[model samples]
Target: MAEVATSASSSANSSARSVSLLVVVDPVARRLDGESVRIAKDVLSAGASHTKVCLPDDPEEFARALGRRGSRRPVVIGDDSALLRAVALLHRRRELAGCALSVVPVGSALGLARSLGLPTGAVAAARAVLDGAERRLDLLVDDSDGVVLGTVGIPPVPAPVPVRAEAGSGPQGAASVRPWLRTCQSLVRTLASSRTARTAVAPGTPGPARLRVEVDGVTLVDLDQPVEGVSVTPGAAGVAVVEVRPLSVGAQASPLTASGRTVTVSGAHFRYRADAVVSGPVGTRTWVAREGAWGLTLPAE
Candidate 1:
């Protein structure tokens, strides 16, 4: 996928005024603070003209807070999943484009949020909510209506169930070493043509399954050909596709790559992990992109 982002020129006065803001602190974040939640609250309270803080206990309450946020900009204080939840709610209500969103990343696996250009620090991110420019960005929405903020992959082995952690548990702080390892992992993923992520299988695990794949309505691989693995990620230009071939008795394995607007995968039941969420065990799935579907608030260039 080509890098998928677009920045609108900032309005001359975007950062000049203190705007009214609805700061919804993710329930998960409230428990994980390690001081991050407090810093976020204090910073946002200080920066906005009128700040209303809502701490929703569950997804329903979270949605209600957003639906009721009249004129105040919403600032999410949680990790990527919390941001994903907010985006999905607003998208379903068809109000996403009309509402620019901000985030104060505060959980494990903050990489996706960071990769989206959000400041990883709670204070910095909260401040950006008040002073940053709004950017329109693309999203990958699957037929199931699930939203993905980052990469999607069909690893050679089954993906692990997503782990949920209490906010500041073992190396859970925003500056913890886990994210550093994740950064190195992401680099390895890139340098290894993504096989480190897409073709990972533990010993004793079953091998990859063959699946038919279609890109932009064009067939990349048909069911007749067996495949070791496949991956689909939303790139700036389009959806990036990769197909890993299993090594033959005498031939080396080769991976195929391509990009398109939509990608379809069908075979026996398969699963994929998209951002922080996982979906499937279904026979087929399709993911399509809506260019510039929503806005993300980020630092002005």
Candidate 2:
């Protein structure tokens, strides 16, 4: 039986040597020094016997690449936006339950990543992906097919539109023409553009849209008053935590909380921000909180 034992040993060695890893880097997340890509490749090389690196131009192409690596874990090298894109794709395909999501944050707008306790630097994030433990987390899915992991809200003002102005304007004009300045101007414009409807507002003044919310088939709030925004946490299952802030107070006041698996919201046309993406202005939509939909690696407690 020496021949049979030798053959089995050879097969085991081949199987051990066949472990492969794929690193999906987002072009937008590429660092100034191009070090994020380098670190990702280096980590994968050191951690696995076989590893491949890929740069996806956008979310669609990223999803396509992910589809090709069936059953192989994906390591995303980007900020929260990129992470959200990956989660959305996995959720859409109903593959989230089986895949372990890894992220290496490499952008300024990484609030969600921070919230999840992911490392800010490329090397630390890479090391986490290589050695971190997986934990199941909740994912929020809205009726418009929007997915959110952290917080989602509808700001009072609409998003800004970029405008180009001639150079050599006055100092004030030049200052106003800057991108951040233009964004502020857009916020002001939105506030000025808000229309007041007698039915939608209280007697004193114009206000936010009044919305009706239902949780798990139970009506939590009827059309009581204008609500500044609604926030939900999908992480808490059987508990649909809802927060309502009024425009007068803005996001200052404490939010309302409820518990359920399904939540339905009805109100005037307002854009929805899921994670970081502005999704829709549908008058009504429902959100279902699915438990244990995906796994993520976080810093050890």
Candidate No. with top TM-score: 1
Candidate 1 stretches greater than 4 Å from native: 1-16, 156-206, 237-251
- For each of the candidates, give the backbone clash count: 8, 2
Task: List the pairs of residues colliding in candidate 1.
Answer: 1-235, 1-240, 2-235, 2-236, 2-237, 3-236, 4-236, 32-167
The C-alpha RMSD in Å for every predicted model, in order, reads 9.5, 9.5
Q: Write the per-residue lDDT of candidate 2 for residues 1-301, one digit (tens) a residue.
A: 0000011133344443334566777766663225665676666556655556677766677878777766567877777778888888888888888888888887557888988888887777777876778888877778767777876665333333335343545432222367777777788855755643232332223346678888888876667766767777775653456776654553465556777788888876555666666655567878888787789876555
By TM-score, how accurate is candidate 1?
Answer: 0.76
Ten-residue segment with the worst summed lDDT in candidate 2?
A: 1-10
Q: Give the whole-model CA lDDT for all candidates, comma-separated.
A: 0.73, 0.67
Reference-based TM-score, model 2: 0.74
What TM-score fits each model? 0.76, 0.74
